[model samples]
Target: MQTIVIAGGGVAGLELATRLGRDLGRRNKARIVLVDSAPTHFWKPLLHSVAAGTIDPSHYHVDLARQAIDNHFEFLCGEVVDIDRAGRTLKIRARLPHALGHESVLRYDRLVLSFGSVTNFFGVPGAETHCLSLDGVEQAEAFRRRFLRLCAATSGGAPRVNIVIVGAGPTGVELAADLRHTVDTLVRYRLNSLESPCQVRITIIERGPRLLPTLAPALSEAAARKLRELGIEIRTNTAVSAVTAEHVTTADGEVFPAAIAVWAAGVQGPAINTRLGIALNRNKQVLVDEQLRAVDDPFIHAMGDCSAMQVSDSTAMVPPSAQAARQQAIFLHRLLAGIERAAIPVFRYRDQGTLVSLGEYGAVGMLRQVIGDRYLNVQGAMAKAAYRVGYERYVMANLGPVRMFAQMLVRWARSRWLMPVKWH
Candidate 1:
């Protein structure tokens, strides 16, 4: 039996691993091994909520070992250090608690790379060291703790608490809103003895001309308007020159005193990707062909935020998004299962649209029209409902529907009856 080793237990890698495990491993055709530095998997999209204290990660993360046992695959908790292309082998270093585990090398018949992205500080001085980021579960939890601490410190003396979020992309925007909601909830629950609920000031700074610049202008305007209505500040076309523990200085010499500074600027492929010796794009993402195979090597394939593929004959590449990653996983499943062998269909990303949740403030979405290139903008109750179930629906469709629903029910019950905020 052939062995398939997938590095990175991210959204794409995990989904593809499970699918291939069921189809090939169960039949004794292939041995599927999923390797990741982290022992558990948490959806990247929900990191913002986690940082804002609006959601708890314990209820959402999937244990890789448990999943591997249930799905008929092997899970290895380690970091891929080196790959010998000619030898078809990889060296992995186990990531233990504070102590480093010995490295182990494993041979594979084929390889798939999907080690997702990391926070790109863009070489900003002091940004990398001082600013908090929502890069992973640990980082998000750290931010949540800092947030609660800041609230506790400022609740009595300070008239206001200022939080500066650099970048107006989806993460920054959604995080600002979620943080605002969390603060209000804290105040309402008497967790913070603030003079007023609006004492916490949140500001998002974006180098781009507007928030959600990749989306339609109308949607951007709607998001901006909604954020302003919620007392959140939006500074567009502003570039940050430096970040410090006390303040964030912009290119224009303006300084914002911040109790908490978050760098939600952008993302790039993990730096270890260079070890693969494959052609990579400017963002350090592996450049792959239409079949999702590395352009320089056929035996290695990449997907998710770690891989970049050109769209058709255009200069544009597929966007790094959860939707795109999920689509590519599904396409790979079909391609690998021999369902499209006669004429291996090229992987094409269907733009289902983008949804931004604002917690209780409301939500905004841009739904792509199935017929044309235009998108329909939606907001209010309909958009909020869609945003709420968007992730649930995706998980249900991909994972077992009944199991996902039961987990969601438990989460809802816990939030409603016990506690909604994740202080611990």
Candidate 2:
């Protein structure tokens, strides 16, 4: 049996592994192996909520090892440091903490790269050292701990806590709004005895002309209005030059005091991509063809945020979004499962629209029509319900309907007694 090795057990990687494992591994046709640095898998989109202290991450994370056992695949906990295309092997480095690391080589008949992108600091002085990012679980947990501490200290009669988010994308916008709701929840449920509510201010600085620039103008306006209504400040067309412990300085000499600074501005491919010796785009992402195979080597494939491919008939490349990643994974799975034999169809991305959550303030976004390119703008209660259903669908797909409902019931029960935020 031939071996298939997938690197980075993220959204695309995990899904593809599960599907291929069930189809090929169980049938004894192929050996499926998944490689990732993290022991468990958490949905990347929810990292912002983790940072905001709104939802418990434990409810949704999937154990990669257990999933591998159930799905007839093997899980390896390590980072893919480099790939030897000529040798058909991968160099993986152990990711054990506080210990000497070791490297190992794994051979494979075919390879798939799904390692996600990392936060791009753009060489801004002090930006990397001072600003926090929600790129992974560890970073989100660190931010949440620090945020709770800051709020606690402020409740003890210190100055107000000011959080500055240096981006207007979905992560920054959702995080700002969620932080506002979290502060209110903390005061109402946990710190009600204090004389005053926790004084927390949120400011979003966008270098673009408006927030959510990727979305339609109407949707962007709706999101901006909702954020402002929730008491979040919005500053557009502002370029940050430096970030210090005390403040964020823009190019125009304006400084904003910040107790916590978050950099959600942008993302780029991981540095490891350079070691692959493959053709990379400006963002360091592997350049692939429409079939999601590397232009350099057909045996090596790439997907998710780490790869870039142009649309079938359009000039735009596939955007690095959850939907795009999921689509690519499904596409690859079907192709590998022998669903397409003679002429393999090229991958075409269909925009299902964009949705931004604002915690208790509700949600806003645009939904693409099934028939045509028309998009219907959504807001308030309907949009909020849709936003929630979207996550529930993802959970169901990941954990199966039965397990998903069981977890939901357990979470609901915990909510009856547990506090809204993680205070510790």
Give the worst 10-residue stretch by lDDT in candidate 2.
189-198
TM-score of 1: 0.96
Clashes per prediction? Answer: 0, 0
Residue 96 of model 1, lDDT score: 67
lDDT of 2 by residue, 1-424 (tens): 8889999898889989988998899999899999999989999998998998888888778999999998889998888888899999998897767422788999998899999999989999999999999989999999999998787776456677889999999999999988887888877776532234437889999999999997888889988998888778999999999999989999999999999999999888999999888999989999999889999999888999999999877888898888899899888888877775648567878888888888878888888888989988899999898887777777676667898889879988888889877666
Model 2, runs deviating above 4 Å? 96-100, 155-157, 190-198
RMSD, candidate 1, Å: 1.7
Give per-model TM-scores: 0.96, 0.95
Residue-level lDDT for 363 in candidate 1: 83
- lDDT, each prediction: 0.87, 0.88
